[model samples]
Target: MAKDNTTAGIIVRTYMVGALFLLVFYGVIFYNLTLYTEDRNSEKRLQLLSEYYSEKYDLADFDTIQIDPLLTIYGDYSNLPDTLSAQFSESWVGATTFHIDNDEEYSVLAQRIASASGNQTIYFVEAIGSVELDQVDIILFQSMLTGAGIFLFLIAAAYITRSARKIGGPISSLSNQLEASESDFSPINLSGHLPDETKQMLSSVNAYRARIKRALHREQLFTRYISHELRTPLTVIKGSLSVLRKSGNDKTLKHVGLMSTSVAEMEELTQTFLLLAREKLDRDVVAVDEQLVDRLLENFSGLIQRNEVHVTRVLSAPFSLDAHPQLFSAVINNLLKNAINCSLGGKVSIFLSPERIDVIDNGVGLGEKPRGYEGFGIGLKIVNDICDKYGWMFKLEPNPSRGCTATVLLK
Candidate 1:
C-alpha cells in the first residue's frame, strides 16, 4: 500500500547511501595505493644511493669492495623480514648483524665492504641521509584528493536535501490548508513549478473542492426551495381542516378534495427536492435521453389543458440534452401554467433545438426573474438551479409582440 512518492524516496536514498559507501571504499583504496607507491619509490631511491656510495668508495681505495643495490634499501625498512644475513663485504664495514625469523644476519651491503675498505666505505652511508621533494609531493597530492572527495560529497548531499525540501514545500502547504478549515471552500491557489505527482494531487483536490462547492450551493437552494414550496400547501391544509371542522353539510367531501390537492402538491415538492438532491447537482453531464424529455412533456400535457391553455410544440427530431428532463418539465410546466393564469385562455408555444428549449408565451411575461410566482414556485428555482448545474445558458427577454420568451440553451 505504499505510495509512489515513498517508493521513489526509498530508491533515491538507497542510491545516495550506495554512493557514499563507494566513496568511502574508493578513499580507502586510494590511500592504500598511495602508501604502497611511496614505499616502493623510497626503496628505489635507497638503492640508487647505494650505487652512488659504491662508485665513490671503490674509486677512492681501489679495493674491489662494493655494496649490492638490493642490500641498501632504506626509509623505514627495519620491518623488512627478508634482508637478514651474517656475511660482510669488502666495501662495507659495519658488520653489525640482526636476527630475522630467528636467524642471525648482517647487512648484505656491509658484507660486501668488509673484505677490504678504508674510511670511505659505503657502510651505514648506504641509506639515504635526506628526504626528497617527490615523496612530499605525493603525500600532499593524496591528501588533496581525499579532501576534495569529501568536500564534493558534502556539497552534493546539501544540494539533494535542498532540492527535496523545495519540491515538498507546496505539498506541505496544501496539506496545511486542507487541515485548516472545512467551510473555506476556496480554490487551491498555489504558485510554483510543481512536480508531476504534486500537480496531479492538487488537480484532484481542486476537482473535489469544485464538486463540494456545487453541492453546498445546491443544498442552500434546497433549503430555500423547501421554505418556498411548503408554505402554500401547509397554509392550505390548515385552512381546509379548519373549514371542515366548522361546516356540516358535505364538509367531509370538501375537506377530502382540498386535502388531497394539498397532499399531492406537497408530495410533488418533496419528490422533486429529493431528486434534485440525489443528483448532487451533477446533472451537469451529457447523455440525457430525448425520450425522457418527451415523456415528461406528455405527463404535463393534461395540466396544460386543465388550465384552459393551448400548446404549440415544435421539437427537433431526436435531439438530446445534457440535463435532467424531469427538471426541465417542471420548468416548462410552471411557466406554461403561469401564462395560462395570466392569459385567461391563452397559448404556450414550446420550441426545441439541438442546444436549447424555448418556451414562449403570448401572455404575462417575465417580471424580473419571474421566480416569485408561477404557482409551481419551487419549480422555477429548480429550473434555474438545474440550468446553473448543467452550464445551460438561460435567457428571459420580452417578446416584441406580447408576453415573454424563456430560452434555456445547452452550450
Candidate 2:
C-alpha cells in the first residue's frame, strides 16, 4: 500500500499524535490529583482521631489501643507495624501509606502530644481499603477518559478532514486546469473561497500564462517576418535559375539545376519553420504517398550521387497522417538527409508501413561523423518536436550489427 503523502494526511496524523499526548498528559494529572486528595483526607481523619483520643484518655498510659476495627493507635514506635516502624524516627511527623497484603492498605500518621510527664509521640494506623480507589474504579475511570478522548478525536478528525479538503481542493483544481490546458493561454477560473496561499499561486500561474502567450506571439511575428524577408531573394534566385535553364548552354545548366534545388530546399525549410512557429495547426491531413517520398528523394538525388550512397525504399502501402504537409515533409526530409549523410558511400534504406516509418543506415552508425558531416543537429530536434506534438513515438537505436535505425511510430 502506498503511504499518504498529501497535505491533509500529514495534518491529520500530526493532530492525532498531539491529541494522544494531551490525553496522556491530562490523565496523569487527574490520577495524581485523585491520589493527592485521598492522602489529604486520610491525614485529616488520623489527626482528628488523635485529638479526640487525647481528650478522652491518657496519652502515656497504654502502648497500643484498638479504637475501631479499621483504626489502631500506638503510643510508641516499638508497638507499630514493621512497615510503619521502618518509616518513623523520633522527629518524624507526617502521614504515610503502606500495604500489609495484596489487598490491604493502611494510612499511618505520627503526631506529638503534650502529657503531664513529658512530650509523647503517638502513631495512628488507619485501614483505608474502602477509602482508596480500587483497581476496577481506576480501570473504569481510564476507560471513560479514553472513550471521551476517542470521541473528541473523531469529531476533531472530521473537522480537520473537512478543513483539509477546503484547503486542498482549489490547488488540486488549479493543477488539473494547468494540465488540461494545451494551447489555451486564458487565465484559470476557480470558483470558491480560496486561501491566501492559493490566491498567490493562482496569481503566479496567470502571470506565467501571460508571459508565455506574449512570447509565443512574438515568436510567430518573428517567423512570419523572416519568411517574408527571405521569399524575395528566393524568388529572384528562382527566376534567374529558370532563365539560366532556358539558356542553350549545357555547361551552366547543371549549375542552374543545383541552384534551383538549393532554392527549393530553402523555400521548404522556410515554410516548415513558419508552420512550426504557430501555436496551432490548420486541420489539414497530408497523404504519405510514394509521389511525395519520390519528390523528396529526387531533391536529394545530387547529394546521393555525389556521396555514392545506395538508397532503397519499402513502401508497403500508402497512408494518410493528420498533419500539415510542410511539417510532415520536414520530418521525412530531415530523417532522410541524416541517414544519407551518415551512410555516405554506403547503404540507406527506408521502410514505410501503417504503423511506422523506419530509416535504417549501415555506414558510420551513431557518434561517428564523417568529415564535413554535422552531427544530427536542429533537424532531429525538429523531428522530435513534431513527433511530440503529434503524440507519435520517435526512437533512434543502434542496429545489432552496424549503424542505427530511426523509427517513427505513426499509429
Name the best candidate (by TM-score).
Answer: 2
Candidate 2 overall Cα lDDT vs. reference?
A: 0.84
lDDT per model, in order?
0.60, 0.84
How many steric overlaps are in each model, in order?
Answer: 14, 0
Predictions: Cα RMSD each: 18.6, 7.6
Residue pairs that clash (backbone atoms under 3 angstroms), model 2 = none
Best by lDDT: 2
Candidate 1 residues 1-411, lDDT tens each? 654353335445765787789887987787667655544555555456566665565334342333553344322223223343223334334333232443322222332333234334333323221332344675687778878987988788777766766766787778778878566778786787888888889899989999998887888687667857786677777677677656745868665655655565565556566665653544443333456556655655555665567877776766555555456555665555555555545787877777777887777665633324335455557678767766787777889988878788867
What is the Cα-based TM-score of model 1? 0.39
User: TM per model?
Assistant: 0.39, 0.62
Candidate 2 wrong stretches, greater than 4 Å: 1-154, 186-196, 289-292, 372-376
